[model samples]
Target: MAPMAEPVAAAPAPPHFVIVPLPAQGHTIPMADLARLLAERGARASLVVTPVNAARLRGVAGLAARAKLRLEIVEVPFPADSGLPPGVENVDQITDYGHFLPFFLALKELAGPLEAYLRAQAVRPSCVISDWSNSWTAGVARRVGIPRLFFHGPSCFYSLCDINAATHGLQQQDDTERYLVPGMPVRVEVTMGTRPGFLNSAGFEALKDAAMEAMRTADGAVVNTFTDLEDEFIACYEVALGKPVWTLGPFCLCNRDDDAMASRGNKLGIDQSAVTAWLDAMDTDSVIYVNFGSLARKVPKYLYEVGHGLEDSGKPFVWVVKESEVSTPEVQEWLSALEARAAGRGLVVRGWAPQLAILSHRAVGGFVTHCGWNSLLESVAHGVPVVTWPHFSDQFLNERLAVDVLGVGVPIGVTAPVLLFGDEAMRFGRADVARAVSALMDGGEEADERRRRAKVYGEKARRAMEKGGSSYESLTQLIQSFTLQGGKQH
Candidate 1:
């Protein structure tokens, strides 16, 4: 037995990923979930955020600690002179629409500091995962000699349409004229009015051009959607981009417990117990959950129409009204009167709502949504059909996917898209809202069929995130690839 035992090689260190998210609630929430998922999977994940954004993620940080996951929140100073007021680090905090462009462009300033941080690190990151909006990360990754992956928050369907439109171009006569979107797997129609407003701005075009260039240089993309949800579109997108696109989420599902759900996004306007208690008292599949996301700005008239619509539908509901929308005396009085009339049947939350928790509740039968991708995926993951009311940027396309392709939603019949500034004339009224709600919630064969389809999709979404499922396998492969690359670099 004289031969000395062969020494075993130590396992390679876990791959470390530095995640950079755009400072918006919708964008950051899913990215936060991705960081948590990576940490849980035995990788070191660090989220680089501004001061305000870091504060918003405190709950997520706590979740990671309890789970014993290697998740870190790295704070970077938000660039000043962005035209936004002090302490206004996020899109949701911007009071004026004119400041939006300034806020967007100012984020590019982060590249210098981010590069410095990477260079100073004792061990280089295995990869840099940045939101597609943060296009500046591409240069930083290049300078640091690390791989980078873009994270797209929108549906694969919307992304494919965006790419095709940019490639083939659209010929439109006017804002109302409908044109067939070129190069889609399915027939999708769009009106010039429904096109994203950013497309009209020269400044935004420059930024967009940079983002597209960054996408080309990046190693690949990871989307916050499951393969089962958009398999065809994902395949088409991969072919178009000629890069691997990984589908590793319904990231909201990573928050498995009540504590995690309640704290998943922005700060809650009301206590979690209060919302849960209200839902607990309602009958199963009885409450309609209403929210238009954090950044959507609607005038007081729109709020009143929504209020009257919920009252007219005669259904129990929970509606999230941004505090900014009700600052005027007229809107306040109108909301008060509506709340009084619909007492015990409807609840209106004034600011941020525990959206994930509300959607997860059994009492939530349907959702009145603005077709934001995160909201759409959450609704699908919970088996809730929707009344679609899209507002601006990618929302109209997302609505088409929900209503036409998925068959789990009914449109509220806003034929024209509105701008982000809430300056456009109101189109849909109370009656439109009531009709869509009734179509979704009323007990009929059609309504039941919609609910059934939603349930099936929800089940498939959950299954895809479990071990041996499509998303699970994709995530495993993604980490393994990074690990191997990291070892080579070492």
Candidate 2:
């Protein structure tokens, strides 16, 4: 076995922490963020990962030495019968277009590594921080005699609807009622640029049950969004879980330190130099940088249409289209055309782009995104407006947050013909996309007003993460409460 890992910082030999995050990028990024947070707060943490994903985790751990964090990374070996191909446990392993329930057996295989690590620890952990997907880890946490803290990392409005709809019932046919959920008189339209019309769909039930159980059973539950963004929903979570719902998030702070970056240097082996140089060359608020995140399968046709659409619009762009997400000849044609047509006008990154630097860059005026919580939050935190294309999960709600509540984005609905800002849907359309983007960028009238409002919201989000902010207070209080309970490792 690999040498038993040890913590980085010194703080009374701190509480040992074991974190098992979901395998997807969205899940992994937040999990890494939380691990970094715990480490910085004087916690000694052992973040577990499959051998295949160790590199990815390393990228997250980067070599940071904050005052109180000693973070060690442990890689769990893959079992022979996992059925997944060799080196296929990471997020980039496959592009199957569905939920991954079929791999439960493979997932459960981690119990052995998890159990072994617990047995080997010199100082046992006070608690286990886990993701919703790793429900089976509850068994490991229980057996290890540690209280578990499950992180949901979801937006409030979506999470609340997940819980409430489970009890109050949601109707399938009604769009208006979808917005006006039972007991929520103010129509919790949490997504940007879209209606809450599809909450009753079958996609949300398992997630709700799993998340609800995780919160109910754990000592405490944590979310990545802020209290101001979801006060009502957090209250709902607090009540349902019968435990404090600490909203110590947006979870983007993990990347704030050098250690976080250093940990990943040897792991990802990313070729970021070219992308960085290209981005540096772009004029302020000019390049349309893009990436659909790790899990989003890039449909080539849609990629082509997007390229075509951007080309037709006569704008500069940077589109990242994953090879796995696109597998057609026509898409190749579009890409070929894009290569020739978009020399100065566009640059497609093809894989993951450094999101943080991109968002903060003066060149990126907006984001065209799949509305994952992190990406949406990143855009909001940076005051960059968005073109929201919700693919799944709480994304639909996040789309609403951008388009409706925040006024920083517009919905580019993602059904039938993939809608950019203005294309009409069963309800909304391209005129919408173009107009919205135009307004936010330079369009006069309400356009400037909306951008101004968006900047204010972004500032508020910044405040939540600052000293004495809601998230900061919540974090301090959470640690204090646990400390008061004797700070004992179970």
Candidate 3:
């Protein structure tokens, strides 16, 4: 052998990322998608979740393995005295709003176990990407010497407005006053009634402080949005944070196949095939898809109003009713009667339905949604216009983006936000719901325009994630930075 050729150097291992998501459906779904995206991009990504949350990831785990991606699910023990019942590790699982605080604060307990887990790993993660709510990770990242990137689940518009409103003390103003949010790229108005309940709760002040501190110390931020969707807001947010901000999303697109779409979030209550069959039977762009997100708790009156509104609209529809909302016997009877009256025209799914799959269906013309960021993006990505019905938190701000900025949504005329636990006074009844639904689903010039705009944005969203696209480039830059840092350490 001619002086044996010098052994070739093996390629450096791909950068490894540890992702921690707040244990809620809206937060975890996008984070899980991000984890998949990272693994797909030739990186080793692990998702740290509690045992209960791990169960929700089984489908994701299988899909990743099938694709030969280095995606993993790591389990850390949830604190024992978390004030939540056993196996209740997610925000959606909390029936009583009283446990919300304890559930939120309990996330801090994971920092210690998470740090130990990181130390025990054979290959240290190149970076730790965590949810903004899990602010405790800041200390862990600092102690472990791993760079931390905060992953925000909402839009740049919402984040910027929220920060500005809080900084300007707008939350303390009168509930009816319309105050222009300070320091935003656009003129966004907010009212105290529309602010999140947590903003006024003294019990939640500590958690909020910690989250703010974490943002101040974070290496940067990774948001689940595309620049094409929120270009100006993204630029403003980056400046506000005074750090690098990466926009690499509409992460739902990572779920390429039916298996992935159907299994994207928590386990389904109804069979995916059943949902598909129902949709396939309906006319194209004729069905209204209604969902209030995972955490919203609607009283019986609200549920009845929604049911009556859908029934009165006479449009083919699929409504997802939370199991918690139908606990009372009166509500159950009312639901049964409504189902009987609207058998073929309406389908009501109890508990979690395959939301992604349903929205992607051609039959879905419009969505009556709670204006959750994930739900809004999903609707936009699928070219489905929305009837915005914001609940709380950043939802009101998100509604403004969809209705005012994008012009792809019509508001359902609910002006005030309700507490998650409080007995909410019904503001908009069946008439408001029926009017919004009819305006969106029925053939009207405004409705057609809204649909057209949503379709165009949907196309832009898809293109943003393609190779060499804006989001793709951003993700590539982020990964390269991490890889370089990892190489230096080695």
Per-residue lDDT of candidate 2, residues 392-458 (tens digit): 5567776666676767776665542222212223333334444444545554666566557656767
Candidate 3's C-alpha runs over 4 A off are 1-7, 168-176, 196-200, 421-423, 487-490
lDDT of 3 by residue, 1-490 (tens): 5788899987777999999999999999999999999999998999999999999999999999998999999999899998789988998888786888989888888988899988877767799999988999999989888899999888899888766665665533355577667787777777766653233566888888888889879999999889889999999889888899999988999887889987777778899899999999999999999999998878887788889989888899899988888888889999999999999999999988998899999999999999999999999988899999987888998999999999999999877878774336648888898999999989779999999999999999899999988899899999999887773331
Q: Find the 10 residues in a row with the least total lDDT in model 2.
A: 416-425
Weakest ten-residue segment in model 1 by summed lDDT: 194-203
Model 1 CA RMSD to the hidden true structure, in angstroms: 1.8
Candidate 3: TM-score? 0.96
How far residue 171's Cα lies from its native spot in candidate 1, in Å, is 5.5
Residue-level lDDT for 309 in candidate 1: 88
Error of 2 at 479 (Å): 2.7
The estimated TM-scores of all candidates read 0.97, 0.83, 0.96
| All-Cα superposition RMSD per candidate | 1.8, 6.9, 2.1
* Models sorted by TM-score, best on top: 1, 3, 2
Which residue runs does candidate 2 get wrong by more than 4 Å? 1-12, 65-69, 97-99, 171-180, 188-212, 257-273, 281-283, 326-330, 415-436, 484-490
Per-residue alpha-carbon lDDT of model 1 for 1-490, expressed as tens digits?
A: 6999999998888999999999999999999999998999999999999999999999999989988999999999998867678998998888777887889888999998899878877788899999988999998999789999999889999988877777788656456577777778998888877653234555588888888888888899999888888999999988887899999989999988889987877888999889999999999999999999988878877777888988999999999998989998888898998889998999999999989889999999999999999999999998999999988788988999999999999998876667675835758788888899999999799899999999999999999999999999999999999988773332
